[model samples]
Target: MHTPTIGDSVDVLDTPSMVVDVSIMDQNIAKMMKRFEDTRKHVRPHLKTVKSPLLAQRLLNAGARGCCVAKVSEAEVMAAAGITDLLITTEIIGTVKIGRLIDLVMKYPTVKVVVDSIYGANELNLAMQQFAPGMKLQVLVEINVGQNRTGIAPGSEAVGLAKHVGGLKHLRLVGVQGYEGHLQHLAKDERVRLCRTAMEKLSATVQQIKDEGLTLDIVTTGGTGTCEICAEFDCVTEVQPGSFVFMDAAYRNAIGTTYGNALSILSTVISRPATDRAVIDAGLKSLSNDSGNAEPKAYSSMRYRPAGDEHGILEWHDLDLRLDIGTRLELIPSHIDTTVNLFDVYYGIRNGIIEAIWPVSARGKVQ
Candidate 1:
């Protein structure tokens, strides 16, 4: 029942806590906005990374056009917090989710969603008709630009789907969403080259939809790695770069340090069993490892291996440090999205003092 209050020193927080340097995070956002200033696109940062409606508002205040959520459940949380300008990036199907979406839109009419299949679009359209009669749901046709994940094929397939959505009385086709997720972690040259190709296909598809006299007002796409390239492309109305706000080790390796690592998992050294090895209290449950193991911020020369759900083993082969029990160190997550989901709150710090404590509002909204 302890509440973390502002103005307290960050050291008062317990170890293995998720912390963010607000100054660095602000700089990251500023740098990202600068990159898109000269381009013909707006920023609609993806909410799957930060997951906090408070953070979403910060982005909106920082000149973002809107925000993107990966699920209808996530969209619900954001909309509840007055972030109605949301574009749910995933397809919403199933009667349960469609029912929820209908309820959500009844209150916040500005919420938009993406549809990859005609079945999903038709299902949503039917729900809108049944639940909210005479209401039109704004939707974007998702094109599989390169992710090969949840989108229709780019060229003719996208046009066909857009046309199909236009015919639905309860569904309105607004735009297209094509995320270059695969290129988000590639090398600079390779990322740029492949991202252009993906954007080319997406742009052409958007033009084709427009040429068919469809209502294609939005072409939402891109990620932190390819947001700049995506913004420079033709017909791209906005970019959805999520991870740039709190840069992770994986993105850092790919895109370099355009955005600083603003977040970390602070852990305490529990046991210095050996001269070269130390045990800490952060592990798989605290940090994500799907992308790679989290890196020790100050102990970059050391290798970190999760011992179990509660402990991490650190071994030093090159750099020697004064290691002792109760020593606290912060770890930069390899994947920010999954790691942030593991924590309930983010301790926002500035000059080693806590300035804010934001709840992860949409943490488990994976539906």
Candidate 2:
């Protein structure tokens, strides 16, 4: 299909740009909303996937309770877009970062953040006390739900951290967020079992906090891989799945999501380096190598390898190659989130002429 036409045509746009199928994106959003229809869980979709406030608005319209961003800067962009309710899933660190977090809360009045350590909670408390003393920051106790990346131990230690953050002057313990990051792509039965096992810790933590006379409002967990499994857990009140909205190569190959390949890097054939090898415009710069390099999914038989910065070498001479000079090809990125930040705006399309240009509003929100 061609790119949907808005005002400008697709041919005039820059190469190696991110092009999204708006219709496909809607379908993806609808599919996720449908999953949460009869369930009690809230779909606080991870905005880190698109990093676009425009897309986040669409997500809200499509039945998301709010958006979950990884950083305070991302929350700022979404708040600027008029999205008042937001959850910062990452651990808010440093005076500078906490200062920004307090600023965001003061600005939006509905922004929340996760804190796993007493040090982080204390820092936030100090920042709020010094600056926005009246601002109330909702804090989610992040438990180690098999990711082991951040978060405290799931049982009593989690309760201790929650109690500490709760007793803080400015920070209020709103809920618990446990991410099953490691279970995102596990084999089906194993993924379910591991996610359940992880939630067991999270559920116990929630109970322990409740036993201490604390209000446990939110018990959020899950990613695209184990969303269904997480939904079944009685403790989990919400899920923060980012990749479901835009299935990347790793997720598509991992979870078998029904969402089509909506996000693609339209690359042009730059050079045929050798008879056994070819090169394209997209590389480590345009796409991402987080999950591994992008593979030629449509052309699975072809061996797609990255040569360097802006070059993707393809060893696909065999199997009747369709690539030629100036031939535009769509590449599925290895990681959707990183690849999306590589562009300024997404060419939102329907039937493909370039329906709209939506900026990546929260791109590079590393702080």
lDDT of 2 by residue, 129-160 (tens): 88988777788998997788998988888989
Best by TM-score: 1
Q: Which pairs of residues clash in candidate 1, taking residues 3 or more apart in a chain or in different chains?
A: none
Q: Would you give me the overall lDDT of model 1?
A: 0.91
Segments in model 2 whose C-alpha atoms lie over 4 Å from true places: 1-9, 317-319
Question: What would the TM-scores of all predictions be?
Answer: 0.98, 0.95
Model 1 over residues 99-196: C-alpha lDDT tens digits? 99999999998999999998999899889989998789999999999888899998898899999999999998888899989899999999999999
Error of 2 at 16 (Å): 1.1
CA lDDT, every prediction?
0.91, 0.83
